[model samples]
Target: MPNPLAAVAAVMIAVSVAARALIAHRGYLAYDDFPILSMADRNDPTPDYLFRLFNNHFMPGGHLLSWLALRFGGFGYGPFLALLVAGQAAVSVAFYRLLRLMLPATWTLLVPLTVFLFTPLTLEAGTWWAVGVNVLPMQLAMVLAVGAQVKYVRTRRPLHLVTLGLSILLGLLFFEKAILAVALVFLVTACLYGDGLWSTIRRWWPSWLVLTGVSLAFLGLYSALATSSVRRPSSVAEVLTFIGQAISHTLLPGLIGGPWAWFPAGDGAPIASPPPAARWTAIVITAAFVAYTIWRRRTTASRAWLLLVFYLALVLGLLGATRMGSVYSAVAGSVPRYIADVAVVAALAIGVALCGIQEREEKAAKIRMSPILLTGLAALLLSSAFTGIRYGDEWAKKAGRDYLANARADLATLPAGTVFMDQPVPEGVVGPLSAPYNRQSEFFAPLPEGPVFVTQGRDIRVFDQAGHVVKGWIDGPANRPGPRQGCGYRITGGPVRIPLTASTAEYWHVIRIAYLSDRDASATVRLGDGEPRGFDVHRGLNAMFVVVYGGGAEVVLESGDPAAGICTDEVAVGDLVPAPAN
Candidate 1:
C-alpha cells in the first residue's frame, strides 16, 4: 500500500510545479535575460564562446543552454519558461528524496517538505529565466549530492559515492558557487552521523580527500578563466550590515511567509519590502519555533540548528566579502537569488530537528498532527503562495515586455534593408553598462527580421524608447558655416577646412552634412586631429550623418577623387535626435 504521506507530498510537489509554470508563463525576459539571448544569437557554437565567462561566472553549461534555446526556440518565451518549470520541478522531487533519507516518514515530514515547496522566498529564482537557469541546476545538484552522501553513510556503497561526486560536478558546471556544496555535504555527514569530528574525519578521510582535490582543481580552473575581480568590503561595518540585513530583513522574514510587501524594481522583477509589522511577526514566530525545538530535542536539535547556522555563515560570508563592493550591494540580500539555495538546506535542518536522523531499518514514527501545527502550516502556505503570486504578477507586467513586443511588431512592418543608425537601447530595455548587448542592433538580433543598422547613414531612422521609427537628424550649438548661403563647405580638391565658431566637446559627436554632389564619390570627414571617418557620397542633394570621436574648432572634408567633388551646404556637430514631423 502506498503511504498517504508520500501521496500528499507528491500532490504538494505537483501544486508547486503548477504554480511555478503559471508564474513563469506570465513573465517575459528582462534585465540579464537579454544579454544571454543576445550573446547566444551573436556567437556560434565555438569553444571560446561556449566556455566564456559571464560576469565572472564560468558557466559553460548555462551558455550552451541559452544557445540551444535561442536556436530552437526563436524569440518566444515558451522554451525558456518550460525549462524553468522543469528544473524547479526536478528540484522539488530531488529534495523530497533527500528528505526521506534524512528523516523519518511521518506526518512531521510533511511540514518541511511543504515549507520547501511553498516558500515565497524562492519566487525570484523560480520565475526569472536568467537566474533560474543557473540557480536551479545548483539547487538540484545540492539535494542529489546530499542524498547520495546520506546513502553512502548508511551503506558505504561505491555507487552512492560516485553519484555524490558527479552531483557536485554537475553543480560546478552551472554555478561557481556550487563549490560550497562540498562543505555542505561534509557538514551534514559530520554533524548528523559521526560521534565526534575526529571519528567522522577518520571514517570519511578518503571521500574527503577525493572531493577536496576535485574542488581545488575546479577552483583553479575557474580562477584562471574568470575575468571579474574579487570584491572586498570597505569596512568591517559593511560586512556586519550585510549579515544583519540578510538574516534580519530577508531570510528570517522569508522563512515565515514574508516579506508580504512587494515593490517594482524598474525593468526587473519586483523586490521584497515587507512592512515593519510583518518583519516583527516573522521574527517572533521564527524565534518561538527555534526555542521550542531546542527545548524539546536538547542536543539533537542544537546540533541540527548549528549545522544550519554554519552553512548560512559560509554562504553569506562569501557574498558579503565578494559582492559588497557592487553598486547593488546594499540591497543584494533583499533580493532572493543570492540565497535561494538555502530553501532545501533549511528544509533538511527542520526535518532533522523534528524527526531525528534516520537509522538503519528504523520505521517511521506514527505521530498525529496537533491543531496548532495544522493551523501554522495552512497559514504559511497561504501567505507564501499569495506573496509569490503577487510577485509573479508584477514580473508579468514589467515594462520591458511591452517594449519588446511593440518593437518586434513594428520591426516586422518595416521595409527590408531600411538603414538605421546604431545607438544604446533605452534604460528601460537594458542599462548602458550592458555594453554591446545594450546596443539597439544587438538587442533586436533575436528577432527573425529587422532593418539593417550602420554607424552612419543618409536618410536614417532610429527607434524611440516607445519602439516607433522616426527620422533622425543631428543638432548642436557649434556649427562651421559655409562660405556663402545655400552653399556649404565645398570639398572639390585636397582637403576643405571650415573653421567652427567654437571648439566642440572633447567626447564623441555626430556630424551632419547637407550637401550637393556633382557625381557619386567617396569622402572623409575629420574632427580636430581625430582619425577621418569615411562615408559614401551620392549624386544630387541630400543630407548624411556620421559619428566621430573627439572634437575640433575646425571641420575638414575631402573627396576621395578630386574630379568627383561634393559640396556641403551645412555642417553641424552634435547628438542624433528624432526630426520633428512636419
Candidate 2:
C-alpha cells in the first residue's frame, strides 16, 4: 500500500536538512565547535593544523565537514553535524534501494531507516561535530558497502560488484570504523550468505577479489595501536547490560524517558563490570535467533539472527580486546555507535519476521498492514526530524567564515608554548565574573597540543603525567619566585599548611613560587607594596615559593619574562582574599 523505501529516505533527509538549517540560524549552537573555527581562522589552516583530530586525538570527521561547510553553513557546530546527519540520509535511501530482494519492499525499507529515527542513538551521535561525531558517516559507509554487496549477490551484475568494492574502499576514508566495513560485509557473506558467495564470486570475480583485498587492507590498518587503559568487565552481566543499553537505547524509543543520554545510578558508578541487562538481552536475542534459525532452517530470520550474532560478536570482541572498546566507551570517538550498524544488518537478516511469513493470505494481510506500518514509520521519522531541529538535538556548520579574529589577537600576545592555568576544558569561557578571582575562576586548560597546562587550584590534574608532586609547588610556572620572599611567606620541610585566604572587590593576583631549592635562589624583589627582599635559597634539594594573593595583583612570576603579561587566558578575579596583615 505504501512505498516504504522512498518515504523513509525522504523523511530522513528532509528532517536532517531542517535540523541543519535551524542550527545554522542559531549560530554555533555549542562552544566546543569554536576550536575548528579557531583553526580555520589561522593563517595556516591545513590538515597539519587540524591534525588534532586524526594525529593528536581521534575526533570525528565533523571537523573536516565543518571546515568545508564554511562555504555553505557558516560558523555553527549545529549545522555541520546536521549536514552529516542529512548526508547519511542519502545512504539510508541507498540502503533500501540497494536491498531490493533481500527483503520485501516494506521490510527492506523500514528496517534500515528506523535507526535514523531512533531518537536516543541519533541524539548521542548528534553532539560535538568536531570530535567523535561521524558515527553517521561511518554507519552510512558500512551500510552502503554492505548494500552494494547484497546487490551483487542478488543481481550477478559486474557493476554491482565493482560498486561494492569501491564503496567499501571509499568508506575507509570516512572513519577508522570504516576499516571493518569490508570485513563485516564478507563476514556476513561467509556466515549467512554462505551458499551464494561462491556463485556470486564466480560471476563477479574481478570485483569480488578487489573488494575482498580492500577489506583485508582495511583490517590491517584498523588494528588498535594506542595503549588502552580501559579495564574489562568484572562480570558478564555488566557486559550484557552495556550492550543491551545500546540496543534498547536505539530500538525501544519509549523506554528512554527524556532528553538526557546516560543515567547515573550508583555513586561514582564503580563496578569493574559490564552492563548486565544489555549483555543479557544481546545474548538471549542471539541465542533465540540462532535456535530459531536452526529449527526453521535457512530463512531470512536465521540470517538476521546470524547477523545479530556477528554484531554482538564484534562489539564483544572490541570490549574483549578491551583496548579499543574501552577507549570507545570512555572517549566515544565513534565505536559504540557501530553497534547500530549491526542492528541494521540484523534487521535485514530477520527479513521474514518483519514480513510475517510470505503467504497468499499474508499478501492480502501485508497490503492492510503495510499502510499502518508506513503511516507510523512516517509519523515517527517526521516527529524525530522535528524534535531534532526544533528541540535542538543536533547542529551543523556555517559557511566557513573567519572565527580566528579573537584567537589570533589573543594568541599573538602570549608566548608560544605558554601554559595557561585556566579551568574547564579549554573550549570556551562561561558565566559572569565579579572581579577579584579565586578557585572559582573559569578558564580553558587542556588544549590540543603546544604547551600543556597543569593546574592544582581547580579541577583534576590528569594533565600531570607524573605521579604525585615530588616537590609540591616548585614545579609550578618557572618564573613564580620573586613575589613570595618579597612577601615573607615560605614552605618548610615540616607540615606547614598555611591557610592563605584573600578577598577583594577589584581584580588582583595570587602567585606561589617553589624553586628546586632555596640555595642560590637569590631574589631582589620589590613588592608592589614597595617592600623589597634580597635572599638566596639552596640549589639542588632545596626549593622556593612565592605567592601573590590580593585584589588585582598583576605581577609576573618573573619580571621581563615576555610571556607573563595580560594573562587573560583566565580571569581569576572574584571576591578576593584581602591584602596580608601588616
How high is the CA lDDT of each candidate model?
Answer: 0.81, 0.42
Candidate 1 has an lDDT of 0.81
For model 2 the local lDDT of residue 535 reads: 34
What candidate 2 gets wrong by more than 4 Å, as runs, is 1-63, 69-75, 78-82, 106-119, 131-133, 154-158, 196-208, 215-241, 247-298, 319-338, 350-582
lDDT of 2 by residue, 1-582 (tens): 876556655676566545544434443434334444444444144655443433223333445655566545454344565565566456556655545545455543454446443443344344435332445566667667777776665676777776777776555555555656666677666654555767645654665587768867655544443333346665565565555544444333311211223332111111111244644553555456456444644454455555656765676566444433342353222233435455455545544434433222234334234575567556555545543443342233311112222432344455454433432221122112211111112111112222234332211121111111111222211222233433333333222122222223232232333334323434433223323333344444322223233332332222222221111111122311222225
| True-structure lDDT of candidate 2 | 0.42
Q: Can you give the TM-score per candidate against the true fold?
A: 0.95, 0.55
Candidate 1 lDDT at 268 equals: 82
Tell me the deviation in Å of residue 470 in model 1: 1.5
Off by over 4 Å in 1: 360-367, 478-480, 561-566
Residues 281-379 of candidate 1: C-alpha lDDT, one tens digit per residue: 888998898787777666667788888888998889888867888787777768777888887678788878777776721443333467888898999
State candidate 1's TM-score. Answer: 0.95
